[model samples]
Target: MKLTQIDKVYGKKHVLKNVTLEFPAGKITVMVGPSGSGKSTILRSLNLLVTPESGQYDFNGHQIDFSQKLSSKEKLAIRRETGMVFQDYNLFPHKTVLNNVIEGPTQVLKMGRKQASELARELLAKVGMADYGDVYPNELSGGQAQRVAIARALAMKPQYLLLDEPTSALDPELELSVLKVLLQLAHEKQSMVLITHNMAFAKQIADKIVFIEEGQVIYDGGPEEFFSADNPNGRIKNFIASMTMENLR
Candidate 1:
């Protein structure tokens, strides 16, 4: 997926400024930055949660011009190609885990109950939540809820998965559980764009690292070169160092 010359504005505030990014298929690209730096906005824009004011977006044979208003069919097509997971898991409170997972496939995709239920169970099992299918979302822990959320997103079989702070609400130990699942997905060559403050996690799993600050991208490169001694991007280096120190505290 590629986005070119993207720009976003909220009244007088410029949230994203001329942003261009490439998300290589079958690899993980991580976006990290201080809060409110437009990282989530970029992720949201990819799936059109928040449309950019101007840009070119290309994904899986569909190309969109942000300058023009998209028809309903165009919007649905774009959404069908991408799946998004939010920070809070965003599960339906009254729905059982099985129901939540099957809702997308049965409703939007017009899948039959038996097939969607079978897929939902398989996905829940994949995420280690097979036994919790009948339970409500409020009954699960943060990590468990997030896993269910992931399963729900994967049920759509989207071309790409977009995650915003997937594990931010969990404790360090709990975060590892979610991270382990994500690492497994990475190994399976799932294409994803992740936004997180976990520098260590980014270093461990990111195929490409993107650093955004003040509504602009400051660094975009491979992990090895990004942390190498010879690299001269002081802002990113300093940011990583500070995050590391905080993690230790």
Candidate 2:
């Protein structure tokens, strides 16, 4: 997926400024930055959840001019190729885990119930949630619920998975559990675009890193240089130091 010169605004506040980036197939691209730096907007824009005000979005040669309003059919087509997992698990409270996972396939994809359930079960096992199929979202730990969320996304057979701080609400132990699941997916070559503040996790999983600040791309490069002490940007170095200190505390 590619975005060129994308710009977005809410009222008078410019949320994204001429943002251009690429998400390579079968590689993990991590977006790391301070809070309110437009990382979420960038992630949401990939699925057309947040409509940009200008520029182009190209997904597999389907070019979208953001200045023009997107038809529902266009949005659905983009979304069909991508699945988003948010910081909150956002599971259906009244649905069983199996039901929650199957909803998208049955409703959106129009797969038969039996076929959707079979696919859902396989994805649930893939994400280490096989035993939780009968469980409700409220009954599980944050980590388990997040895993179920992952399974639900996977069940949709998305070509690209977009995650926005999927583990941010968990404790350290629970966070690691969710991170482990993501690491496994990365090993399996699932194309992913993730927005995260955990610098260490980003380094461990990123093939490319896009550091955003003030609604602009501060740096777009590999993790080795982005995490190195020799980084030339003073503000970025300071940001790293501050994040490190926060982790320590």
Candidate 3:
């Protein structure tokens, strides 16, 4: 995916200012920054949840013309290719875990109920939640809830996945569980744009890292180039130092 000269504004404040970056296909790209740095906003704009005021989004070699108005059908087409996972597990309270995973496939994609159930079971197993399909979201820990959310996102067979702070809500032990599942996905060659503070995880799993500050990308490079102390970008160095301190504490 490529973002060219992208610009977004909220009321009077400019959130994304002419940002341009290219995300290689079929690679894990992690976005890291301090809080309120617009990392999530950049992800949201890619799926059109937050429309850009100006600029273009290109996906799979097709340039998304944000300048022209999109029809409902066009919007749905883009959404079908992208899936988003939020920090909060947005599962339906009344639905069982199995049902929560299958609901979108059955309702949105019009898959047969039986087929959706089979797919749901397969995805649940993939996320290490095969035994919890019958359980309710409230019965699971925060990490489990997030795993179920991941299963739900994968059910749509999205070409790209957007994750916003996937482990921030979990305890240390639970955070590892969630991170493990993400690492598994990366190994399976899933293309993802992840917004996270876990520098260690990023270094291990991300093929590329994009550092954002004040709604613009300040550094974009491979893990080696980014983590090197000799790097000249002060913002990148300081951000890495802050994350390291947070992890140490």
Candidate 4:
């Protein structure tokens, strides 16, 4: 996906300002920034969850005209191609883990119940939660809940996955489990735009790192370039320092 001159605002507050970047297809790209820096806003805009005031978003060779209003059906179609995994595991409280994973395909995509169940089982196994299919979200730990959320998103077979701080809510041991799943997905070449504070994971899995500050991208480059002290951008250095402190803490 390619974004150009993207702008977004809430009343008088501009959350994103004329941001431009390209996400390489079939590769993991991580976006890092402090809170309220527009990192999540950028991801939400791609799926039209947050409409941009002005911008061009091109996906798979089709340019999205922000100025033109799309019908509900059209917007749903775009969202179907992009699945978002939220920081909070947004599972239905009444649904079992298996049902949560299968709900989207069976409802939205109109897949047969049996087919959806089979697919859900496969994805649950992929995320190392095969045995928890019958459990409810509340019965699982935060990491396991997030794994089910990932499986739920994958049920739609999205071309692009947007992950917002996938590990933020987990304990350290649980965080490792979730990150391991993500690393496996990265190796499988899933196209993803991840908003993360984990610099180590970004360095290991991301093809490119985009650093946003106060609604603007201050640095976009390979992980090597981003970590090198020879880089002249003070903003990047400061960002790295903050990230390091967060990790150390």
Candidate 5:
């Protein structure tokens, strides 16, 4: 998926500014920046959860210009190809964990309930939630709900998985569990675009790194060069240092 010259605004706040980015297939592209720097906006744009007010979005061979309105089918087509995992673990409060994971496959993809249940259980097991399938979101801890959310997203079999801080809310122990799942996914070469404040974790999994600052792509390149000590861009180096320092504290 690729975005070219995208611009997004919310009321008076200009969140994304002429941002252009690309997520190569089978690679983990980690997006990092300060809060409200449009990292989340850019990630959501890939799944069309947040549409740009202008410019273009391209997925596979399909190109969508901001000027052209999209029908429900078109929107669903794009969204189906990309699954988004929100930071808040947006599970249905009324639904059990198993039902939450199976809802998409059964309702949207039209898979049979038995098949969907099988798939959901498989994904739940993958995310270390095999035993919690019958539980509700409220009954689970933050990490458990997040893992269930990951399982729910995976159940769709999306080509590209978009995650917004999958571990930001969890305590260190809980965070480690989610990180292990993500690391396993990364090892399998899943096509992922993640927005994370965890610099150390980002460095471990990123194949490509995009640094956004004040709603602009400050840098877009490999993790090595961006994280190098000799990286000439002081701003880039300082941002990493600042984030690292914050993490230390």
Candidate 6:
């Protein structure tokens, strides 16, 4: 997927300023930056949850103009191609884990109940949540809930998985379970765009890293180059160092 000259504004604040980015197929691209830097906004734009004020969004063979109002068909097409996972596990509290996972498939994709159940169970097992299929969202720990959320997103078989701080809501110990599932997904070559503050975790699994600040991309490169002296931008180095300091404290 590719985005070019994307721009967004919220009142007096210009959140995304002429942002351009590319996510290569079957790779993990991690977005990192300070809070309110528009990292999440970019992810939201990709999922069409927040349309850009003006720009081009390209996915598969579709090149959508954000400058114009998209038809309902166009919005649905973009959503069908991308799956989004949020910081909070937006599960139906009344539904069992399995039910939550299968809902999209049965409702949106029009899959039969048996098939959707089968697929949901398979995904649950993949995320190490098989045993919790009968459990309610409120009964599971934060980590387990997020794992189920991941499984739910995967049920759609989207072309690109977009995540906004999937581990941010969890404690340090709980973060591991969700990160492990993400690592497994990375190993399986699932194309993804992740917005995260966990720099260490991001460095571990990212195939490419994009650093943004104050609504503009400052650095875009491989992990090795991003961490090494090859990165001529001193700002990223300082940012990483500051994050490291915070982690130590």
TM-score of each: 0.97, 0.97, 0.96, 0.96, 0.96, 0.97
Report the alpha-carbon TM-score of model 2 versus the true structure: 0.97
The candidate 1 region of ten consecutive residues with least summed lDDT is 240-249
- Separately for all candidates shown, the number of backbone clashes (residues 3 or more apart, or on different chains) is 0, 0, 0, 0, 0, 0
lDDT of each: 0.92, 0.93, 0.89, 0.90, 0.91, 0.93
What's the CA error at residue 162 for candidate 2, in Å?
A: 0.4
Off by over 4 Å in 1: 246-249
Screening candidate 2 with a backbone cut-off below 3 angstroms (N, C-alpha, C), the clashing residue pairs are: none
Which pairs clash in the backbone of model 1? Answer: none
What is the per-residue lDDT of model 2 for residues 18-119, given as tens digits with 9 covering 90 to 100? Answer: 999999999999998999999999999999999999999999768999999899999999998898999999999999999999999999999999999999
Tens-digit per-residue lDDT, 1-249, candidate 5 = 889999999999898899888899999999999998999989888888888899898897778998678777878998888989988999999999999999999999999999999999999999999999889899999989999998899888989999999899889899888888988998998899999988899999999999998899999999999999999999988899898894366
**Which ten residues in a row are the worst by lDDT in model 2?**
240-249
Model 6, 1-249: lDDT tens digits are 999999999999999999999999999999999999999999999988998889999999988999899888888888888989999989999999999999999998899999999999999999999899899999999999999999999999999999999999999999998999999999999999998888789889999999999999998889998878557778888888787784355
219: Cα error in model 5, Å: 0.7
Which segments of model 6 are wrong by more than 4 Å?
246-249
How far does residue 202 in candidate 3 sit from its true spot (Å)? 0.7
Compute the lDDT of residue 228 as modeled in candidate 6.
81
* Candidate that beats the other on TM-score, 1 or 4, i.e. the better one: 1
Regions more than 4 Å wrong, model 5:
246-249
* lDDT of model 2, residue 70: 93
Candidate 2 runs further than 4 Å off = 246-249
Clashing pairs in 3: none
Q: Residue-wise lDDT of candidate 3 within 1-249, one digit each (tens)?
A: 888988888888888888998777689999998887788889998788988878998886556777788778767877888888998999999999999999989989999999999999999999999999899989999999999999999999999989999899888899999999999999899989999998899999999999888988888889899998898888788788888894366
